[model samples]
Structure formats: C-alpha cells, structure tokens
Target: MKFVSWNVNGIRAAVKKGFMDYFNEVDADFFCIQESKCQAGQIELDLPGYEQYWNYAERKGYSGTAIFTKHTPLSVKYGVGENDSEEEGRIITLEYEKFYMVTVYTPNTKRDLSRLEGRLQWEDELKAYLKELDEVKPVIYCGDLNVAHTEIDLKNPKTNVGNAGFTDEERGRMTRLLKAGFTDTFRHLYPDTTDRYTWWSYMSKVRERNIGWRIDYFITSDCIVPAIEKAEIHDQVLGSDHCPILLEMKEF
Candidate 1:
C-alpha cells in the first residue's frame, strides 16, 4: 500500500496553498501529517475515502498531528504517556490488524540547545514506547523527527555540527532507535544517495539554494524491510518548510 507523510507546518494554511492538489495527485492509502497547528473542529477537510484522526496540543495553533487513512484502524492512541501528553501534541498511533502505524512530530531542540535535555528524554521514552508496541506487532513509524541523522542528511554537515538538530546527542538517539530493530526505509533503499532533503530553512534564499535537512522519514520494523517498495521525498511539492515523504509497501 502507499503511505505518505508530510509536516505541513499548518494544515489550514497548506490547504490554501495547493495541499488539496497534491493530496489528490498522490492519492496514498494513508496520509500522515505533522505540525497541523489546528484542533478538531478548527478546520474542515473534505477528503473522500479517508478516516481522519488528529491529536491537538492544548495550546492553540501549536504542535499537532493527524492521520488520514483509507482503512479504519482497530484502535487509535494520542500520545505515548501522560508526561509526554502535556506539551507538544507529537504522536498519533493507529493500530490496524497487521501493524501499528505511528506518526510523530518530535520536539525540536531550540536554536540555543536549551531543550536538548528534554529532547533526549523524549527519545528514550519514545523508543521504550515503540518497543512495547513492537512486542505485540510490527510498527510503521513516520514523521518529521527533527534530526539530520548523518552528514549525508544535510547540505553542510560540517557547518551544522553541534547545532540543535544536528548535534551528536540528537543523532545518537536516532542511531539507538535504528539499532533497536527499526529500519529507516529511505536509507535502506538508497544508502549512498546524496543531495536529497525534506525540511528547508525559511531563511532568505535557503530553499532556493537547496540548503535543507532530511529530517522526515518512514521507519518500520526490521522484519518488514523486504516489503519496502519505495521510499521517496517529494521535494518539489511546496507549502511548508518541509515537503512530503512517501513510503510504499505491499499491504500486510
């Protein structure tokens, strides 16, 4: 089946900026979104053949995530735990008969690295949560994880060293996650590919210069690696600082 993930920045704004067009064109079986910035009833989206699920932050117009899926999930979960439920509506887990699908908008470490410790804690908690779920069934996790995994994941890794998202601490968490039986679908497909990215800086001429980070991803249990049909970055699609990422696989 076809699955797509995008950090729309703001769902309301993206709808007005050709989100519908891209949505129709892609026509994925599951459309996952992060940074929706809207609560239930705040916006209306008339997407046919899709079941909508959203987790909104208590604060207005902040971090939020949504899943639009053609198949109905057996269960839906909002956050990992009560502690993480407080700030940053970051995760949404959809339980299907065969696998659990999780979409996350990982908390970003502030430019000054002020939130690094919290982000690290989140990584620990998130990995524990995923492992707990994996014990029951395989998982398909996707989202804007807010970290450029390696030097190949960003435009200028040398200059970005020790920065918030590129810090060794942040990248180390990702390493631990993958080591814990998850496979980054994109890298699994094209390990040596370079110059491809998903999130771009909104700074002056950054997107134009293609200075961006491949922070968004689709990761699945190691057992499902053979089923990954395609993992792609739709960099040409626009509307937010991050473009859309696609992960196609055979239906379980």
Candidate 2:
C-alpha cells in the first residue's frame, strides 16, 4: 500500500500548476493534502476511483485538509476532541479495518511567534488524541506538521533556531510525541539524509538552492514500523512551495 502526503499550499492555485497531472501519475492508495484553503462547493474534482473527504476551515480560503483514498474508511472524524479546533479544519481521521489514518495540518506559530502558546497547546491535545487512538489500533499519521524536529531537518538550523517552526518549544513537542511511541518514517529510514526537504520558502532562489525544511512527515505507531517498505521525499515534484512525501508499506 502506498500513502502520500503533501501541503498543496492552495488547492486552486496548485490545480493550475499541474496538480491533477501529478495526482494521476502517483496513483496513491491514500492521497492526503494539507492547506487546501477551500470549502465544499468551492471546487469539484473528477477522481474516478477515489473517495474524497474534506475538512474545510470556517474562515474562507484559510487552513484546511482533505484526503482522497481508493479504500473507503469504516469511520471518519474531522477533529481530535471538541469543536474548538474544528474551525480551522486542521485534522481528519479515517478509521480503516486495520489502522487509523490521520492527516493534520498543524497550526503555524507565525513569523513573530505570536501563536506559539496556542500551537504548543494544540500539540499537547493532538498527542493525547493520537495516544487514545493508538490504544485501539496502530495509526498512520501524515501531513505538514509545521515544525522542524531537529537540526538535521532544516538547512540552516543555527540561523533558524528559535524561529517559528524551529523553536525549542515546537521541536520538543515532536520529540515528546515520538517518545510516546511514534516513529517518524523518513528519518527512521534515512537518518543521515540531508538537503531533502518537503517545504520551502517562496522567497527568491530558495527552492532552487534546495534550502528547505522537512516539516512534513509520515509518522506511525512504533508497532507499524516493520510494515514500512519505503519513506521518500519527492522534492522534484512541483506546484506548491511544498512537495509530496511518500510512504509505502506492506498491506496489513
């Protein structure tokens, strides 16, 4: 089975830039996208074999997520707990027979770190939610998490330290989550891999220089690690500031 995740940045804009072409080419079993920035009735997709599930933010054209899967889920959930987080439409959980698949577009801390407290609070709540789900079955969690977990995750860690996504608070939450029994599939498979990133700044020549951050991820319950066949960063694919990351696994 192949699972793919990407932050389209903006679905409407990406479509014009060949999103459908790449979507058709990959043909993933579970294709999850973040930052969709649109609501139902705003756009239509003619994906013949896939079941589309979308979680749109209350605020128009803001943060949102969607999942297109060939396999229908047994149950679907929009957010973690209360409806407080549902406004941004940041998370979607699909319960399959064997495992739970969750796609999350984590809240960003903003350049000025204004949202750091809220971001951290969300992480705590999210971690608890994942643990609760894990008690029932293993999980396949993927999306643009919006944090660089370690120095190896970004090009200029020293300079980027304490910044929005690289702040100690943000990175520590990721470490704590992993310690709680989840494995970051990509780093687990290729520990030494560098210059391989999922999201890049849209600033001039940044993407071309390969200066980016590996904020997107495919994290799974530690018990599912043995099933992972491949974890890859498709940095070459283009349309948004972020590219797709893939996880191939043996069928459960």
Candidate 3:
C-alpha cells in the first residue's frame, strides 16, 4: 500500500499549481493533506475513485485537514485530545479493519514562543489519545507536525534552537511520543541520511539551497514498522513551502 501526506498550505492555491497532476501520478492508497485552509462548499475536487473526508476549522481559511483514500474506512473520527483543539480542524482519524490512519496539523507556537505551553499540553493529550487507539490496532500518523525533532532534522540547528518549530520543548514532545511505541518512518528507514528535508522557507532562494526542516512525517505504531516498505521526502514537487512525503508499506 502507498500513502502520501502533504501540507498543501492552502487547497485552493495548491490546485492551481497542479495538485491534480501529482494526485493522479501518486495514485496512493491513502492521500492525506494538512493546512487545507478551506471550509465546506469552498472547493470541489474531481477525483474519480477516491473517497474524501474533510475537517474544516471554525475560522475560515485557517487550519484544516483532509483525507482521500481508495479504500473505505470502517469508522471515521474528527478531533482528539481537548475539545478546544477541534475548533481549528487540525485532526482527522480514519479507522480501517487493520489500522487507524490519523492526519494532523500541529499548532505552531509562534516566533515569540507565546503558545509553547499550550502546544505541549496538546501533545500530551494527543499522546494519550493515540495510546488509547493503539490498544485496539496499529496506527499510521502523518502530517505537518510543525517541529524539526532533533538537530539533524533541520538545517542550521544551532541558530534555529528555541525558535518556534525548533524549540527544545517541542522536540521533547516528539521524542516522548516516539518512546511511547511509535516509529518515525523516515528516520527508521534512513538512519544516517542527511540534507533531506520536507518543509522549506519561502524566503528568497531558501528552498533552492535546501535550507529546510524535516517537519512533515509518516509515523506509525512500533508494531507497524515491519510493514513499512520505504519512506521518502518528495522535495522536488513544489506547490507549497512543504513538499509531499511518501510511505509505502505491505498490506497489514
């Protein structure tokens, strides 16, 4: 099975930049999107065989997520952790017979780190929620988590430390989550690889220079790691600041 995840930044703008072309080329078993920035009745897709699921934020054109899949999920859920998190439409969980697929757009704490505490709290609650679900079946979690994780996950980590997405507290949250029986597929596959990144700054020539961070991910329960065929960062495809991420796995 093939899975794809991307933070399109905005669905409408992505569409204009050939999202359909990439969507058709991938033909993923499940395709997930974060930062959709759209609400109901805002955009229409012409996908032929995929089922679409969307969670729109109360605030228009802000944070949102969607899932397009060839296979039907047995059950679908929206929002996890605290109820207030639901107001931004940051998460979508789809349960299949064998596993749960979750997509999330983690909150950015801001350059001033004003929202760091709230983001940390959200991570704790989200971890608990994932643990509860893991008791039943494996999980495939993917999206723009908004954190660079470790020093190796980003360019110029020394300078980026304590910045919004590179803060120590944010990285700790990811570390703890992985320790709790989840696997980051990219790192699991390419333990020593370097200079491969997913999200880049839109500033002048930043992307061309590959000055970016590995913020987007395809993570899974530890038990599901054996099934992962390959994990990749699609840095060449660009419609947004973040390029697409790919994960291939055997049928569970």
Candidate 4:
C-alpha cells in the first residue's frame, strides 16, 4: 500500500494550485493532509474513490487536518483527549483493520517561543494517545510534526538550533516519542541521510536551494518495520511550505 502525507498549508489554496492534479498523479491508497486551514462547509471535494475525514480548529482558518482513504476505516476519532489541544483540530485517528492511521498538524511554538509550553504539553498528550492506541495495534502516524528531530534532519542545524522548530525542547519531545516504540519510517530506511528535507522557508529562494527541514514524517510502531518497503520525500511538489512524504508498505 502506498501511504502519503503532505502539509497542504491551506486546503483552499492548495486545490487552486492543482492539488487535484497531484492527487490523481500520486494515486496513494491512503492520503493524509495537515494545515488544511479550513472548516466544514467551507469547501467541497469530489475525490471519486476516497472516503474523507476532516478535523477543523475552533479558530477559523487555522490549524486543521484531513484524511482521504480508498479503504474505509473501521472507526475514526479526533483530538487527543485534551480539551485545549482538541480545540485546534490537530489530530485524527483512523482505525484500519490492521493498524491505526493517525494524522497530525502539530502546534508550532511561535517564533518567540511563546507557545513552547503549550507545544510540549501537546506532545505529552499525543504520546499518551499513541501509546493507548498501540496497545491494540501498530500505528501509522504521519504529519507535519513541526520539529526537525536531529541535526541530520535539518539543513543548517547549527544556525537553527534554538529556533522554534529546532529548539532542544521540541526535539527532545520527538525523541521521547520515538523511544516509546515508534520508528520514523524515512530515517529508518536511510539512516545518516542528509540534505533531503520536507518543509522549506517561503523566503527568498529557499526551496530552490533545498534549504529545508525534515519536519514532516511517517512513523510506525516497531513491529511494522518489515512491512515498510520504502519511504520517500517528494520535494518536487509545491503548494505548501512542505512537500509530501511517501511510504510504501506491503499491504494495509
């Protein structure tokens, strides 16, 4: 099965920029999107063979996530059981027959690091949520996690060390999550790989220069390692600061 995740940045804008064309071309069995920036009734999509699920934030035109899958999920859930975090519509858990597919648009600590505390709190809650779901089945967690993980995950680690997304605190949270039995599918396959990134700065010619961070990911429970045949970063696609990341597995 081909599972893909992308941070469209805004659903409305993305659609206008040939999202449909890319959608058809990629032809993933499971497609997950983050930073949708839209609410119910705001937009309509006519994806022929896909079942759509969306979670929108209470604040209009803000953080949101969606899942488009060819196969119907046995069950679906939104939020992380935390009231404030739930308000932003950042998380969606889709239960497939063999695994749980979770898509997230992780909260960004502002440039001044004002929301760092809140982001950390969200991480804790999310870790708990993943652990709970893992008890039943392995998980396929994918989205714009908003952190560059390690030095290798970013283009200029030295320069970005304490920045909002690369702060030690944020990276530590990600470390804790992975240590709890999850594997970053991409890095797992290409350990020590560098320069390949997902989210790029919109400023200047950053994308052209490939000055970006590998903040988006496809993570799974350790047990599913053998099933993950390949993981990729589709840096060519544009419409958002982030490009779509791909994961090819044996079967869902």
Model 4 residue 126 distance off true place after TM-score fit, in angstroms? 0.6
- 1 or 2, greater by TM-score: 2
lDDT of 2: 0.94
List the RMSD of every prediction in angstroms: 1.3, 1.0, 1.2, 1.5
- Which predicted model would earn the best lDDT? 2
User: TM-score of model 3 relative to the true fold?
Assistant: 0.98
Q: Could you give candidate 3's per-residue lDDT for residues 1-252 as a string of tens digits?
A: 999999999999999998999999989999999999999999999999999999999999899999999999998889884453488999999999999999999999998899999999989989999998899999999999999988889989999888999888999999999999999999998887889999988899999999999999999999979999989898999899999999999977
Decoy 4 TM-score against native: 0.97
- Residue pairs in candidate 4 whose N, alpha carbon or C atoms collide under 3 angstroms: none
Off by over 4 Å in 1: 81-86
Residue range with the least summed lDDT across 10 consecutive positions in model 3 = 78-87
In Å, residue 193's CA in model 2 sits off its true spot by 1.1
Clash-forming residue pairs, model 1: none
CA lDDT of each candidate? 0.93, 0.94, 0.93, 0.91
- Using TM-score, rank the candidates from best to worst: 2, 3, 1, 4
Q: Ten consecutive residues with minimal summed lDDT in candidate 4?
A: 79-88
Per-residue alpha-carbon lDDT of candidate 1 for residues 1-252, written as tens digits (9 for 90 to 100): 999999999999999999999999999999999999998898999998999988899889999999999999998888785543545688999998889999999999999999999999999999999999899999999999999999999999999999989999999999999999999999999999999999898999999999999999999999888889999999999999999999999866
- Candidate 2: residue pairs that collide: none
- For candidate 4, what is the lDDT? 0.91
